[model samples]
Target: MAGVESAVPGASAGPELAVDGASNPDIDLLYDINGLTKSTPDWLDRAIGFVGEYGLLIALVVLVLWCWASVRRRPEPEVSVAGLVWAPLAAGIAVLINIPIRGFVERPRPFVDHSGLELLVDGKSDFSFVSDHATLAMALGVGLFVANRKFGLIGIALALVEGFCRVFMGVHYPTDVVGGFALGTATTLLLAPLAMALLTPVVTAVSRSRAGFLVRARRVPLPHPAVDLPEPRVADDATDTGSGRNDLAA
Candidate 1:
């Protein structure tokens, strides 16, 4: 009887909970693009992946060197000092903002979501929204540009390249990189003037100290005196005397 009752097909089951797993459409598009990049030569793939993962460190070092060169008595010392002071400052601001957002957003990585995909570099399963690379790179680029056009242009290029690489390597979404760049650029520009003002005294004092010998003028305001010094005392009387002598000789 118990078997017969069990066989009566457990009274019709209630409707099951339908879990809506809809994902952002951007993910598919970005994933498609990343896949396309893999068709390239293996050498290229490896090279690009390396750049995407590690090239920015080189870029950051280059930026620091640029600032250092400028600060160390190079042309446009004021601007150089600005670059030196602001690049790290902006990067720090970017990192600060990124950390909180990363935690709050908590997005999944592509590799984790889609297994079987080849990875050229080490990847993380943590959130990928708003890439830290893009944020910091953009901040550094903008800060450098503010200080010097040439350095700024280079920085911007480097940031753009790094963003593309982050997307190409499949570690980050296109939106993640784009959002990071936008966020970083905005934060740095907005915070730059205030940060610089607040840090000036401290930086200046440090630069002036013996330890800052590497910095030109120790951050001191130097004379950029106008090139137009009153035309060297015209020696009007000497010329007049020469004219009279010529007349007498004639």
Candidate 2:
């Protein structure tokens, strides 16, 4: 019996070894599910890649230009100057707050740590708790919205597209994008009012200083009333005839 036991393949290794060597069927199933691979379409991959790379920058530049043009077209010089100064300042604050918050979170990038996930673009990031792209997009959206509700809605839509592209590109996890968006929105909601308040004086001063330039460059001046006149005088003959008829009828 002793010889037979000793001859068994793993008998000498003990029960601990047996347990340690045992394969976990549950884990195997999970691994299979996790590893269930699907190929990304070439066009989708390319489109996602292009948007992920340059979309935000293009959107931001266009927004800036649009805001500038909108303000420039405004009849009120003060409003135009305010838009220019406030828009850039709000954008800057959003970026500053977003960067530090992302750095602190330091979450692992999806492709870096998640097994069986394919990365379309190689992103050298150890910190991926919150996506910078999403953050910036949200910030831009909120900032633009603050400046002008109509334009802000447009900005938000563009930002959402950019954030979704990050996920579709397999560069960031959905959670990362969500977190970034939340952080950005919170930052904007909190800081935008404060920034506007602080910038109000500065913007006012700038607009006043530049009023002369606007006056010089002005192609047109607002039209004013040429004259103020008294109520019109009806013909005395018509008034007397109407009065005479009423008197005769009475």
Q: Pick the candidate with the highest TM-score.
A: 1
With candidate 2 superimposed using the best TM-score fit, by how many Å does residue 33's alpha carbon deviate from the native?
A: 16
Residues 191-210 of candidate 1: C-alpha lDDT, one tens digit per residue? 87887776666656666677
**Model 1: residues with Cα > 4 Å off, grouped in runs:** 1-25, 74-76, 114-118, 217-250
lDDT of 2 at 209: 76
Across residues 1-250, which tens digit of lDDT does each residue of candidate 2 receive? 0001111232222111012211854223323322322444556666667777686758775985686556555566454445445555655666677677656655555444334443546644556657777877777777777766777788888888877677655556666677768877877778766676776566667545756443123458779878879888777998999999999999
* CA lDDT, every model vs. true structure: 0.70, 0.60
* lDDT of residue 131 for candidate 1: 92
TM-scores, all models, native as reference:
0.70, 0.64
Q: What shift in Å separates residue 27 of candidate 2 from its native position after superposition?
A: 17
Model 2 vs. true fold: TM:
0.64
